[model samples]
Target: MAKQKTAFVCTECGSDYRKWQGQCNDCGTWNTLSEVRLGSSGGSGAASARSSALSGRRGGFAGAVPESRLLDDIDCEDVARFTSGTGEFDRVLGGGLVPGSAILVGGSPGAGKSTLLLQTLCHLARTMPCLYVTGEESLQQVAMRARRLGLPTDQLRLMSETHLESMLAALDEHRPRVVVIDSIQVVHSDEIASAPGSVSQVRECAAALTRFAKQSGTVLLLVGHVTKDGSLAGPKVLEHMIDCSILLEGSDDSRFRTLRGQKNRFGAVNELGIFAMTDGGLREVRNPSAIFLDRSDEVAAGSAVMVVWEGTRPLLVEIQALVDESQLGNPRRVAVGLEQNRLAMLLAVLHRHGGLQVGDQDVFANVVGGVKVLETSADLALLMAIVSSFRDRVLPRDMVIFGEVGLSGEIRPVPSGQERLAEAAKHGFRRALVPKANAPKHAIPGMQVIPVGKLGEALDALEQ
Candidate 1:
C-alpha cells in the first residue's frame, strides 16, 4: 500500500500548507484551506512509472535517461507568427498569432467577443483547417450565424461536444492548424469531480487544452465569460497557463467595443484596438481621435478638447461641464465616465487653490464619447470646460489643452506632451494650452503653444 499524505491548500491564491489552517496567510481569507491529496495508498512504484511515462516512454531506464539528457542539451528556435487577416488583431498580437500559443479572450455578454473571434477564424480557415468547439451554442445556430456573416466555410469545422478527451482525440485525428473553444467554463473533466464552471473543472480543462496547444503547435483561442463584476470566471491558474489575455469592454449603449491587452508576452500591455459595431460586423476605427472629438462649425462654450494618451497613441477628446445653482440642501455632483474621486479632488483644488466658489453649485462633468479618462493630462481640459461653462464663454476654435494640474493651482508638465502635440497638430489643432515649464520643450510647427502658469492665466488666455 502507498503512504497516505494530506496537505492544505488555499482555493483563492493556491497557497499550500502542511496541515489544515483556519485562514490563508497569503490573501487573509477565512476558511479557504481545503484538504489536498499529496500521496495515496502506497503507489511509489506507480508514481515512478507515471513520471517516467511523462518524461516520454523510455525504451528502457537507460534510454529514458538519455532522452531526458538530450532534451536538456537541445536549443529551441523562436517560432514565427501566423498572420491573421485583421490588422487590429495582428497589432494586438505584436504582428499575428504564434503557433502553439494559448490565448484567452474575455469579455462581457454581447460585447462582440464571439463576433471578433469568428471573423478572424473565418479568414484563417479559408486557407487552413480550423475547428470551433462550443458548448453554449448548437451546430445549426453557429452555421446560421456563419452563413449570415458570409464566412468561407470550406475548411471551417464546428463541434458542439465539450468532453475534453473527445476534443483531444478530434484534434489529434483532424490535425487542425487552429482550435477555438467557445468557453472553458462549460467544459468538464471527470478527474476533477466537480461541476462544470467550478474552480476545479475550469483549471483542469484549460490546462489540458494548453498542453495540447503547445505539444501540437496549434493556436488555441479560449473564450472566457466575465463575472458580473467584470472579472474572468475561473481559477486564477487559468491565466497563468495561457500565453496571452485580452479583455473586451464596451459602454452601456454598446456602440463601441475596446479590446485592451491585459497580458501579452509578445507586445506592450497598453496597446488597444478600437472597433465600432455595425450591421455587418465590428469595423475597426483607424483614427480614434475623430470619434471622441465632437466640434461644431461654430465655437461653443462648455466644451474643451484635451490631448489624452492611451498607450502609445495620442487622441484629442472633448470635455464638457455644466454648473447650476442647487436648490436642495446638498448640491448634486455627478461625473460621467470620469473618476468621481478625481473630480471631487479637482473641485476642492479649484475652490481652495483657484479661488472658485462652487460649494453652492451643482457641477456635472462628462468626458465625451463615453471614453474613460484616467490620465492627468485631461485635467487642464476639464478645468477649461468648467470655467468656460461658469463664464458662459466659448473657447477659441482649433485649440486644445493638455497639462496636469497641481493642488497648488499650478499647471504641471505631463509626459509625452510633445507626442500629443504632434498628434493634435496632425488633426489640425492650431493652438495648444500647456504648462509654463513646457515652453520650447515641444517643436511641432504650425501650432502656437501657449504656456499657462496658473488657472487665472488660463482663464485670462481663454478670455482673449
Candidate 2:
C-alpha cells in the first residue's frame, strides 16, 4: 500500500513543519500554516505515476537526455525578441519579450495588472496570435472589458477556464506566440488534490506552464495576486520559478502606477515603468520627473528638488516637509514615501549637528507624485527640506541637490554624480549642490556645481 504522509506547510514561504503552529517561523507570517496530505508509493510506483501524469501533457518536450555540447560550439548571439508594441513595457523587459520566457506579474487587486496585460496582449495581437485565459473572469466579462477599452479582439482569443490540462490543450490547438494566464492562483491540475491557490497546486501549475513555454518557444505571462502584506499570493517558490518578476505598485486614488522589476533573467532589475491611468487605459509617462516636481510658479518653502537615479534614468523628485509646534506632550514625526525610522535618525542628526532643534515640533515629510525614494542619495535633500521648513526659508527654484548624509554630520558623495548632474542640466536647473568628492573637473554647461563638505555648509548654501 502507498504511504499516506501529512505535513504542515506555510503558504507564505512554503516551509514544511511537523505540526501546526500559529506563526510561520521561516517567513514570520502568522496563521499561514496549512496542513497538507501527500500520497507516495514505493519508489517504482511513485516514479511510474509521475511519468504517466507528465507524459501526455501538451507542453512536454520530447526526447531523453541528449549529448552535451561544447561551450565553444554554442551560439552567443542575441536572442530573438517580439515587441509587445508598448515602448515602456518593452523597455521594462530589457528590450522585448524573449520567445521562451515566463514572466510573473503581481499587484494589489485594483493596481491595473489585468488591464495592463490585456492592453499589451491586444497590441501584440495586431502582429501575432495572442491567447488570454481567464480563470477568475468569464468569457463575457473579458469581452466586455475589451469592448469598453476599445481593444481589437480579432486576433486575440479568450478562454474562461481553470483546468490546467484544458489550458494546455488549448495552447496546442491555438499555438499562440503569446499566452497570458490571468492569474495563476485559480489554475489547478486534476492530478493535485489540493485547492487551486494552495502551495502544491500553485507550484505544480507554474512549473507546468513554465516548462511548456520553454519547450514550445512561447512567451508566457502569468498574473499573480498579492497578499495584504504586498507579497505575491501562493508559495514564494512561484516567484523563483518564473523568468522574471514584475510588481505593479500604486493606490486606488493615485493617477500614476509604478511598474517595478523585482527579478529579471533577461534585463536589469529595479527598472521602473511609469503609467497614468485614464478612461482610455494606461498611458506611459515619458517625462516622469516633470510630474513628480511642483508646477507652481514659485518654489515653496520646505520644498527641495533632488536628482534620484531610478535604474538607467535620473528622476528629479521634490521632497516636501512641514514642521509645526507639537500640541501633545511628545513630538510627532511622520514621513511619507520615506522610511520613518530613517526620518527619526535624520531628525536626531539635525539637532546634534546642525543645532536645529525640532524636539517640540511635529515634522512631516512627503515625496511628491506618489514616488518612493529608497536610495540614501536623497539624504542631503531630505535634511535640507526639513531645515527649510523649520526656518521657513525657500530653496532656490532652479537648484537641485543630491548626496548621502553621515551620522557625524558629514555629507558623503553618491554614485552616478555625473549622470545626475547631466540630467539636471537637461531640465534647465542652473545650480547643483553635491558632495565635494562628486564635483566634476569641468562644470556642466549652463549649470553651477557647488560642492559642500559638511552638512552645515549645505544649509549655508540654501541661504545663498
- Estimate, for each residue in 1-464, the C-alpha lDDT of model 2 and write its tens digit: 66757778888788889899999988899998877665465887767868976885332232233457999999999989878877778777888899989999889998998899999999889888889999998899888888898888887888898999999999989999999998899999987788888877888789889888987889999999998989888877778778899999998878899998889999988888899999878889898887887567866789989999887778899889999999999999899999999999989988899989999999999998888888999999999988888898888888899999999999999989999999899888999999999999896889999999998898888878
Candidate of highest TM-score? 2
The worst-scoring run of ten residues by lDDT in candidate 1 lies at 59-68
Q: What is the TM-score of candidate 1?
A: 0.86
Model 2 alpha-carbon drift over 4 Å, by segment:
5-7, 18-25, 36-39, 43-74
Which portions of model 1 miss their true places by more than 4 Å? 1-79, 296-299, 437-443
Top-lDDT structure, candidate number:
2
Candidate 1 on 1-464: residue-level lDDT in tens?
Answer: 55666666666687778988798889999987766444344567688888978987654311223434576687776668888788777777767899888999999989988888887788899888898898899988888877787777667788897788888999999988888899888997665555787665777688888888877889999999998888887656678879899988897676888787878887777567788988767778888889887567777688888988776678788888998889989988899878888888888888887778888988999988777777788888888888888878888768989898888889999888778888888989999899987666646789999999997788778867
- Each prediction's TM-score against the native? 0.86, 0.92
| lDDT, candidate 2, at 12 | 73
Question: How far in Å is the alpha carbon of 88 misplaced in model 1?
Answer: 1.7
